[model samples]
Target chain A: MQPDDLSRHLAPILGDRLIAVEPFPETAGRVRFRREGALDLFRAMRDDLGFRHFSTVAGIDWVDHREAVYVLWSDDAKQYVLLSVDLPAGDPRIESASGIWPSANWHEREAWEMVDLNFDHHPDLRHLLMPDGYTFHPLLRSFKLHEPEELEVKARHV
Target chain B: MSEMWINMGPQHPMTHGLWNLRVKLDGEIVVDVDPEIGYLHRGIEKISEDRHYNEVITLMDRCCYVAGFSWEHLYILAAEEALHLAPPERAEYLRVLCDEFQRIGSHLMWYAAFVQDIGLMSPFLYGMRDRDLVLDLYQSYTGARMTYEYMRVGGVRNDLPPGFSAEARQVLDWLSRRFDEYDQLTLGSDIFRKRCDNLGILKANDCVAHGVTGPMLRSAGVKRDLRKDRPYSAYDRVEFDVAVADGADVTARYLVRLEEMRQAVRILRQVLDWLDKNPGPVMAEELPRWLGAPYAPIGREGYLLKRNFPKGVGFSAVEEPHGEAVAYVVNEGGEHPYRVKFRSPVFSNISAARKYLIGYHVADIPPIMGSVDICIGEVDR
Candidate 1:
């Protein structure tokens, strides 16, 4: 499963929404797609492509735009495939993959709290690693570690 | 009976770490479960952005305390790929040596705690006593029992000490014998079998759907050991079997872990033999001056030298003691990584607590969770 293979397979389903499939180290390829085709692509990858194992979802803050990378593994292929989508920084939101892959539930929650990438329609979209009422996305570039800031954390289920 | 939620953790013997398991129960039967983690969260990924490439190894040690070397190796593999560097063959073998030994050490720790959870008290002492020997081997070379910051970005910090192989073989010999005694204590005991058998059964499909791995996944008879499926480091060179069982229950998990320990011993024997037969450089040459020096101070020199470095994204997945641990590193021609993301397997395993915990009796929580081998340090990292 190379970049060409992924591009050839995913192009028919995603069409123009499917951007270029670039070569990534170790894995088959990195599938860059439009945010509009997130759910469709996830379904195609899981049902059609036999990527049964959804590994994780990671959020990267590019400062200008935010990116969410979904790592998937196919037991039949014995390989990993990465799905990357770039969202505008001001309102970084996309359809959640939890519906397609239940494993994406916690990963999406972490991405939402840490990088502030909104996974629209994510069930239980709340603080995962962060405390309740924590307002800051600590993984963003602007969240400096050197500076001290006041924090207000409300106890959960009090 | 009315349904009510009960918190099982934050400080519970079954938890083995800091986290809360909110179990909604109808009398004795579990109705639902919501695990509240983050008690041990240290924002390791956030902190990695500020540290230098090599400096991140320190935090990896704390990422998973029992499996420090495995985490260190994971981060190093990713950082090396992002920087377009590779360790020497000898270094790869040394890493395999570290990984296999760490697996044994971690499993021993899990075994100790797990048996205690199931009311078998004596096995806990036996497991800890045996694990100390493995730690002694680590202490002899890495100079730290738990947090061994020995692996560098391109390679390990140093080679094994003289006569280390002989000492390690002795410990392995002792452990191989102790494994049978462990089976006698647990498998032979009626209390252990009655408590653990047919308990916490997460079948192969549920395991894959919920992103479970390591012993829990293998217990469902999934021959999906990453070392065999996707060989990394010196794993391709070693000879070992993927431990699998069809039970998919607590006993199945126990069987898988025990077999995995045996296979780890088998891998260590081969790695030790290879280390004895071959002698070469552990650290890779042609590294930049800042990263090449074993004890180089974190300074502006690294920043200056990294200006011309090629930028790349590195993704590495290692079959960690708990499960599959992944590290993604992005290098944007800076001394520090632009972003570092980790996928801790325990996190996903615990997230599926609701799937397995519900429908079981309240008294069965300890043995069920014990089989999952919860390591909250990595989960909340």
Candidate 2:
């Protein structure tokens, strides 16, 4: 499947929420959708497009805005599809994809803790790799590696 | 009976690494499980943002100690794509050689540890003894047994030493014979079958829905291998079967991995023949000075000469010994990658612990997790 195929299939369901379908290497296309239509796009991709395998979800901090990228694989098409949504930096939130793909559960948790991207209505949105009560999101562009004094980690039990 | 939670790890022989497995038990049966990871989390992703593209290869080696070459190949493929550089064809063949050898080494390590978990002492010694030969081959070329920082961004750091293929062929011959001996020691014994068979049975549907992959998925009779389906590197030119078993149990997982190691030997044989017939440059030509120079000091001189390169995103998936490992490289035109994200297969596999662990006996945890082949290094990276 190409970018045109993805746009033709997703345009009707997403309408204006479907921002654009750009060509990405080694995959069908990169589907850029509005954050509001996140669940709808996920359903269409899984049910309609046959992308059963949920590869991963990644959060990229652009400083101005945050981006959540989802990689999916379709066995029938033998191709991968990239789904990306940009959330506001001040309040980066989007509907969780775990409801559609259970595999997205841990990926979402890692993204939330790493980049501070909130997935509303997530089943268990606790700290995954980070220690509990750790306030800082290390993957953020603003989080400097050289600043050791700024780091404060709290013990989970204590 | 009332249920109570017990922590099996953070330090336990079954865990094989640092991480706690909090299991809720009703009598001797496991009612539920909560795996607490992050004990080994080093924030390699955050550090990748500050390092140069070639320097990231160092971390990839440490990603999964058993499967270092596979991770290096994964990162290199994505970085090369992001930088708009194509490695020489010989480099591609050499990489396939490294990957196949790593697969055998990793599986042997798994076999050794797994058999010992099930109370088989002799097989453990045999597994480790055979794995050393594969490590010796790696030391000959890469110069390191565990953390081989041999792979470069554009290509490999160097070529094979003199008569390396002949030495590797001997190891392959020895391993192929040892695989049959392994089956006799394990499959031929009644204790091995009684412990592993029908234990931790996760059906095909649950395996997919829960994101379990690698030998676990293959053992469930799903013939989905990235090497065959996606065909990265020289995998397209190779001829090997995707090992599969329908049992979806611990014994079935053992069968699948043993077969996969045999197939890895088959692939290495072809790759070795090709490398011998075609001798040429390993690294790509005309690379940017900073990236092409292997011994260049990590200082301002290299950074100052950086040209404005076209920005691109490179995504690559490789069938690591553990499972389907992916690396995403986002190059926003600079000396360092803007962002590098990796999807470790074991991360998802371990997250689905509840799906398979529940309904099994507490005594069965060791053998069952052993078959899963949990490598915490990659999972917590």
Candidate 3:
């Protein structure tokens, strides 16, 4: 499918919430959406577009604003579609996609802990790769490796 | 009996790497499981932000020690895409050679470990002894057996050595025969069947929901191999079958992985023939001055000229031996990646432990987890 095809398909459902559907090499398209419409877009992508296979949910700290990228694959289309949403850095939170895609469970957990993005209503949203009670978000732009800080990790039950 | 949690490891034989599997048991049956990771976490992703693009290939080698070449290929493809650089046709064929060989090597390692878990003593030695041949092939060109940092961003660091194809072909012939012997050792025995058959059956729907890929997902009768579905590298040129089994048990996983090894050999034969016939450039020409240098020379006019390369996000998913490994690289017009997030297949497969491990006997843990092929280096990276 082409970029314009994706935009046309999501137009009715997303309306103004859908941003530019840019063409991405190897993928169907990069669908940019408003953070508020994450849940609705996820459902449409999965149910309507046949992107049943959900891959990765990655969070990036773009300094000014945080970005949440959801990479999904369609078995029928045999192509990947990237859903990107930019959230304000001050309060970066979006509705969790785990309800629609159960595979999002661990990916969301890793994203939450690593980049410190809040996946609202993410069940079992605890530390994944990080130690419990570890106060640093290491993947952020501000977390410099050269700067040495006291590191203490407390053990906690999941 | 009342339920109680059993900690399998920070150090345990069942765990191949550093992680803890907390199992709640009622007598001998597992009622619940909680896996605690991070023991092997070295912040590779965070460190990738600081290092140059070529330097990150070193960490990919360490990602999954058994399938270092596969991970190296995975990262390199994405890095090359983000930089808008296309490797030569010969380089793509060479990558297929590396990937197929790595698949064989990784499955052999899995075969050794899995059989050892099930008390099959002789095959453990057999598996390792055979895997050494593939490692020898890697050491011939890459100079490192376990951690080969041979893949560069634009292309491979080097091409196949002299007479490498002939040597690789011999190993392929031996492995193809050994696969039949493997089936007789495992599937031919009734005890192997009793221990593994119908054990830890995660159905196709459950496997999909849990994001399980690779042999584990294929063994459940879901024939989704990324190489065939989304052909990357020279996979499109080569012909092979997707190994699948319907049992969805420990034995089924074994069968699928063993068949996958055969297919890898088939692919290697074709790739080797092509490599022998065609000889061309490996790395892409017209590369920026400081592509592979550990530290790019920062000149007096560093600030202005660095913006020559346009920013792009490169995402790639390769059917790793463990499962589907995805790497999303953000190149923000610099020597280093802005952000690199990898989706380790074992990470998601292990996350679905509750679905598979629950209600099985405590003794069955080793065989079931063995089938999953836990590579904690990538899991906790």
Interface RMSD of each: 0.6, 0.8, 0.9
Supply candidate 2's per-residue lDDT for A127: 92
lDDT of 1 by residue, B1-381 (tens): 899989998998889999999999999999999999999999899999988898899999999999999999999999999999999999999999999999999999999999999998999999999999999999998899999989997788888999999999999999999999999999999999999999988999999999998889999988898899999999999999999999999999999999999999999999999999999998888887788846544666666665446989999999999989888999997788999999999999999998888899999999999999988899998
Clashes of 2: 0
The candidate, 2 or 3, that scores higher on lDDT is 2
Candidate 3 residue-wise lDDT, A64-95, digit = tens? 99999999988788899999999999999999
Clashing pairs in 3: none
Cα error, candidate 2, residue B306 (Å): 2.2
Per-candidate clashes, comma-separated? 0, 0, 0
Q: B1-381, model 3: which lDDT tens digit per residue?
A: 899998999899999999999999999999999998989999999988977777788899998999998899899988888888888898899888889889999999999999999989889999999999999999999899999888887778888889898888888888899999998998888778888998999999999887888899999999899999999999999999999999999999999999999899999999888888999888777777566322333344323345446888888989999989899999998768999989899998999999999999999999999999999999988
The runs of at least 3 residues in candidate 3 whose Cα sits more than 4 Å from the true structure, single-residue gaps closed, are: B292-308
Question: Where does candidate 2 stray beyond 4 Å?
Answer: A150-154, B293-301
TM-score of model number 2? 0.98
> Which lDDT tens digits does candidate 1 get at residues A1-158?
88898889899999999989999988989999999999889998999888989899889999999999999999899999999999999999999888888899999999999999999898889898889999999999999997987898898997
Clash pairs of candidate 1?
none
Relative to the true structure, candidate 3 reaches a TM of 0.97
For each candidate, report its DockQ versus the true two-chain complex: 0.87, 0.80, 0.80
lDDT of 3 at B218: 96
Ranking by lDDT: 1, 2, 3
TM-score of only chain B in every candidate structure: 0.98, 0.98, 0.96
